[model samples]
Target: MSPPRVLIVDDNLMNLELVSFLLQAADIDVSAASNADAALRAIAEVAPDLILMDIQLPDIDGLTLTRQIKADPRTRATPVVALTAYAMKGDEARMLEAGCDGYIAKPIDVTSFASRVKAYLARRAASSSS
Candidate 1:
């Protein structure tokens, strides 16, 4: 079987590179976009198995993008995990409300990030197989 594909959407180059590197090390295929528009296009072309999206983007809000992706029948079933620096109260709840399947905070721990992502992906795979 082919490695799972992950779409990462972040405007910050450093964050994007860090997460992309970590995920890639885990043996997953990654496609990145620096903005929401490009992200949407990448999603359409790649049809990734999962998406790790930043809540703050240059053009559209991450929550808005998540909602749009979830609303579309073509991408609705794809899993999305929200990645944000927002540590404010209720931020997790807000991300959940936006339709993300999971959430990860920014300033990610490179060591554990891949494991966390793997856990989610494994869970998703098991659920889908069931």
Candidate 2:
């Protein structure tokens, strides 16, 4: 079987690169987009197994994009995770309410980032099979 695929949407070049490199090292196929428009296009083209969305995009924010992805029948089944710096009170609750399947805080821990991402993918697989 092919390696799992992940799409990361973040306007910050460094964040995007770091996450991409980490996932790649973990043997994931990574696709990235720097903005909402490009992210939408990548989603359609990549059919990513999972999405790591940065909450503050240059265009639409990540929560709004997550809602859009969840609303669409073609993409609803794919898991969307909020990857953001917003760790204040209610931030995670808000993201979950908006439709994110999971959450990952920003300034990610390089040591555990890949495993955490894989955990989400594994959850998706288990849920899909059931």
Candidate No. with top TM-score: 2
Per-residue lDDT over 24-130 for candidate 1, one digit per residue giving the tens place of the 0 to 100 score: 88999999998988998999999998999999999999999999999999999889999988968899888889899988888898779999998888887998799
For each candidate in turn, give its C-alpha RMSD to the true structure in angstroms: 0.9, 0.6
**lDDT accuracy of residue 40 in candidate 1:** 88
lDDT of 2 by residue, 7-109 (tens): 9999999999999999999999999999989999999999999999999998889999999999999999999999989988899899999999989987899
lDDT (Cα) of model 1: 0.91
Residue 48 in candidate 2 has what lDDT?
A: 98
Overall lDDT per candidate, in order of appearance? 0.91, 0.95
As for model 2, its CA RMSD to the true structure in angstroms is 0.6
- Clashes in each model (backbone N, CA, C under 3 Å)? 0, 0
Which stretches in model 1 have alpha-carbon errors above 4 Å?
none
- Candidate 2: regions farther than 4 A off: none
